[model samples]
Target: MHTSVSLKALALLVFCCLSTFAGAAGKCERLVATGNPEYPPYLWRDPQSPKHLIGANADLLTLIGEELGVKIEILYTGPWSRAQDEVRTGRVDLLAGAFLTLPRLEYMDYVHPAFFVTPSVVWVNKDKVFPYSGWEDLRERTGGTLVNNSFGQQFDSYAKANLNLEEVPSLTQAFQKLLLGRTDYVLYERYPGVALANTLGMLDSLETLEPPISSEGLYLTLGHNSACNDAWLRGQLAKKMTELTAAGLPETLLQRNLERWKVQQSQVVAPPPTQDDSQ
Candidate 1:
């Protein structure tokens, strides 16, 4: 009887150990991306539905999550400055999409290669066509930009030293200033500007100046301090992103987002037409 009781206790211990191991193996925890509340077509909060984030970058991240078999969450922390702070302090695991920079490299590891290329375009009022071919062409014009937006390390330096750039709190305000003739021109990512313009029904009011100022590819950045900082994980993500790009994922995602945007736009009820007195 004593021997049997000892064996039963041992078996119970073994079972508990196995149960704990299985629970850990099934754990679905992983680092996710976070960023500012603006930056449309790349990242942005929906005007009509603030909780729903809509854009190309968001779609791309969703695909990445699906490929990795993990859940991707978006944590909005305010502007780019604060969001970068979160990643730096390990408060967040990733910054969904970012331009590769030497300074950023110090605190984070970028997934190998970039998934999408974005051009920095100058937008101006349609009535006043500015012949801006590049940064040099914009020397004489006053530019408006988001407060924490970095065009690139080099461009940021040059703009700080030479250009007359007014830093605004948000891109929408920057575009609004441009439309109100408050600023000479607004410089931002081409796709984001186009997406915002289309959404605001102001696409016809603004035009992208010929020849982009500069272009940069965007990458997913992983915080160096995060538990998900394993080289194998990075390698897997890089490989998946490359495969998606090869499969023409960016274009496909853009088309889907555009269609969704159209649906959302159509859902907006128009004001009832006034009865004409002459009729």
Candidate 2:
């Protein structure tokens, strides 16, 4: 009886120790995040290094990492279209900038409230003015936008069904088409669109419509399949996101980065216009 009791006590102690170790194990000590490299003021490839990402999202994530006591590496693994795939496959732990969509939820979880809210706007050459108040205004006019870009599910559906829109490989192509008067209008986020226009030195030629077409929140989302996607980590991220939102950190980050982006654009040489590919 004494032997049996001693063995039982030993087993219980071992189980307790194991549980403590698991609870204390640094499973989420570090994280990797990535996103579209072309999105300025939010995320973009480091001008010096294509492998690393930089911008407001990177700045905000660094702050988050400090708050959470974790090391977060934001990288630009590839093209924007493939960024989601990298996260979905668990090669990337988080998408530093993402929109919450039903399709995306299947692969990852959104950490709310969003880190930023950006408005998708219509951009037209100063010479190609058109009467535009809403999405319906574009039904009769042809528009160009970046492929794989989503304003929102509703707008995405509407554009597919009613709008005459062409998808190009990059926003650079879309802007080039607009500059050349090949497309009636261009659709893209307001800040990035303006940043692109400034970088291209076409701010005088292009103008964004007031009352944006659609506004979407940009979030820090964790891939469900990521090795670091633990409940504890997710919970902490959600809490931190909420705190950041309440503290207006997102808005501050956006505003600060907007100026930073403009400064960066001014210092760098813009790429030459690309061939029109709005088919």
Candidate 3:
């Protein structure tokens, strides 16, 4: 009887030790995030710190890390598509800014109550402007946008069936194509497009038509395979995001970054106009 009792105690001790180890191992101390490095006023590669990302989304993530007592490092992983791939494969813990879509839900969990709403606009050269009152007006025209970029489910599906859009590797190339008359327009977010155009000295030559193609929420998503992903962290993130959005913090950050981008642009020389694609 004494042997059995001692064996029981030993089993209990082993169980407790294992549980403690697991709890310790599961505890998260830091999170690595990534996003669209070319995106401005939302996220962009920090010129001064090329390996890191900066702007509104980065600022928001920093605030979230402080609240969660976890260090959040927003890295410029690569282009936006590569960044998404990193998050999908668990190489990164979070996407600092991502638009919701059915396929993305398979690999990441979007925190409820998105922190920001972004408008996707149709950009055309000022001299090449057309009468664009709605998405239907864009049919038959050649549109260019970055690879793997989405406006929303509805527009994405519609565009696939009705529009002729080209996928480019970078916004710089897309804008260049539009400016050089290679494409009729470029579909991109208003603020980032404006920021990039201003930086490239092309703002004077471009214009956006109303109304916007889509206005979608920009979410902070945790990778499904991330070691740090757990009920506690998810709950805390949702809670914090709700409170911050209610407080209207995102708009403030965006405005600040807009000016910040302009200041940074002022320090650099703008890219020269591209030659016509045919030439």
**TM-score: which candidate is best?**
3
Could you give candidate 3's per-residue lDDT for residues 21-125 as a string of tens digits? 766444788899999877898998787778899999999999988987889999977777788989999989999988898889999999989888899999999
Which residue ranges in model 3 land beyond 4 Å of their true spot? 1-26, 269-279
Clashes of 2: 0
List candidate 1 stretches off by more than 4 Å. 1-28, 46-49, 269-279
* TM-score of structure candidate 2: 0.87
Candidate 2 lowest-lDDT run of ten: 270-279
Query: For candidate 1, lDDT tens digit of each residue in 185-278?
Result: 9988887778667767889999888787778888888888776666656776788888888989887877777677566657873422322222
- Winner on TM-score (2 vs 3): 3
Residue 249 of model 1, lDDT score = 88
Stretches off by above 4 angstroms in model 2 are 1-26, 269-279
TM-score (all chains, Cα) for each model: 0.78, 0.87, 0.88
